[model samples]
Target: MNKTFYSALNKSTVVLLFLAMTVSGILKAQKLPLPPRANDAISGSTFKNQIDTLSVEDSENQIYQEILNGNIPTFLRDLVPISFSKTIKDSAYVVTYFVLPDYLAVGSDTDYFLMPMTPILAQKIAKAIDFTLPTKQMVDQIWSNASVKLAPSPIPPSAQMTTIPVMWEHNTRLKGKRKETLKQAPLGALVAGHKKDVIISNKIYEKSSKPVVIYGWHYQNGTPIQPVYAGHSETYADYSHGIRLVQDSVLVNNKVHLISKVLQDIQKSSLFSGEGVIEKPFYPVDKIE
Candidate 1:
């Protein structure tokens, strides 16, 4: 073979090998395990049985029906039987703890009236205990029973800000000099990138404010598609341009920290999807009766 031809062939072989390795690494990465599910050992039968026992009384049946219809008035779902390995006196309260996926903590502890629990309060208890909810239906039940009432005092104007709308789209990259549209990317590739971007954007927003509500809804061109996940939201207050909130589907326990980290990552990468909002401040006098 001519020396020039031999050299060209060697370069071509090296390029092909590099491409093969690169492709292999991407495939491996794409094979990452699915996100973990909430782990509650109580069987569905056992949960039903317990509910049945509690519903023996007529009054209890009313409560059970209320819960089933998503009308549990208290934030704490009906308490499952809890056993403490060791009891402590002067504890002020004894409550069952529920751990949410992504590490969120929910407590069934309530005041004397047993009003529904607030997500903010549940977050406080989750800092200490890792408990699991037996079922998602329980969460829905609690939310339904819980009523939203006017604040005891008017909320400060600064605190009453409305959230900005957020949107998510699949990430697309060109392949082999072909400019591929986002719609053309493999589903897995698009999802992975979108998830990472959400994580990144969330961290950037957390530096300023904690998001009170975080839920996932799909969108195309600012229209709802379908809801995917429900979780907490976080915000960044310090940005000079109006307030920005970054939201994501995070494990309950991992919410606060994960949000902060994701936002910071976005700042570092300077990759923002333009999906977020600044809340409008509410005046306490106007809000309160």
Candidate 2:
């Protein structure tokens, strides 16, 4: 995370205390876990649509305003119960938090996913919470519920051509080259490399260019092919682009943190007071002396 970015977070009204223990200096470093390998197959993930198909349109409000007024904790507890908002549903959210985060909740399904692909943005505003990019299948499942048709992919997989590899230097002196192509050892070989090497048959590719087809949008051409991009960017998504599905998932990892006072009650009751450090590290011990 940028130092300037850290200074910006302390100035915001977003409550980050809920996530103190999840990671050290997470605000200064967006070290979210890699994409989960969870089986993203759509098994009961989707639920019946709003009693009547929702006429929800996109909403672009200040995330700070939404978090403050929405009482996000309550929304998380419900976990994707049908929401009725005439103006906005999670389908189209361009909300910006303090570090310029943009996302919204498609709080319609059972999991309550967040879909703004901005991890840096999340840390900047959602200081305590962490997020994981929905798996390829998960993205498809949730985006399927969107109000509009998704865009078509601009690139095609089958249409691409394979490039041949060439070595910069030859292991043996170019003197006894066997292939007719290599035999012509043009002086150009010293500076300009050969057209192609036959030994290296495999084509070189950074990654597949297959597009993520959903979200009423398309994600193409990223390092790992994140569905979201800068304009509103992932197969896995980037730290600063697009939305992610974050709802109950935010506090699921921080259950103890969410209910801080409960721990206080347990401590005061002294129910497990005699336990060793395993149960209560703070418990006093008799001196060895």
Candidate 3:
């Protein structure tokens, strides 16, 4: 009887030890932390190469969509991918526009490069991101979205140069020497979709000899449609009038070739999402239809 009792006691001790070991292993596994970050930026040439090799058969293809879906390691939260149909240089180009975050949404207003500047000054700011005002079609594409709304100038009320009515009146007519008509474009128009109050088209023309005109959006009034801001005969300098930057896009061998030096710069500036959606929220990439 004593031998049987000792044997049972030893077996019970072994079972408990085995259970403890199993529990310990699970606890250790659960406590493991995330891996270290490389934080490397994708170069411009590398970006172009990726786009070239991408098997973009259509909207359903996963290649270009992968980049749009954040498969790329370094991506900006504020950079929205957009494709709008437009005719450029006598050829059709469905270029992608990666929108910079609204000036208000980038943590603080002062953190960004361009706050308020004339169109000429805005071009200088565009240099920081290695972008420029692309073909007129690119501007029209950005304004194509329904979420697109008007942003009023941030200038103080005292600096009033052109009233909304006069600006609209001037833009509604046929081509003329627009230099005299434009007073000042308030600071609001400089940034895209700064306000949702008004909806307007963003296409502006500033050819040296041609009449400057802004293809305006119709605002709801008693009945008639109105216009938005455009350049003038003299320099139309105001804190409100601004310009947009577009990275170069071209069709090579019938494939979309785009170079975004802006994204790389944003990463270097530490304004990127390594894997977290913490800062600079943006819209999804629109399907090419």
For residues 75-104, what per-residue lDDT tens digits would candidate 2 score against the true structure? 232122111111123233121101111133
Model 2, residue 44: what's the lDDT? 15
Model 3: per-residue Cα lDDT over 127-188, one tens digit each: 43344433223334445542424423233334332333222222222112112222433222
Q: Top model by lDDT, which number?
A: 3
RMSD of 3: 22.3
Candidate 1 structure quality by residue, lDDT tens digits, 113-162: 11111222222222222221111222222222222211111112343122
> How many backbone clashes are present in model 1?
35
Candidate closer to the true structure by TM-score (higher is better), 1 or 2: 2
Model 1: what TM-score? 0.21
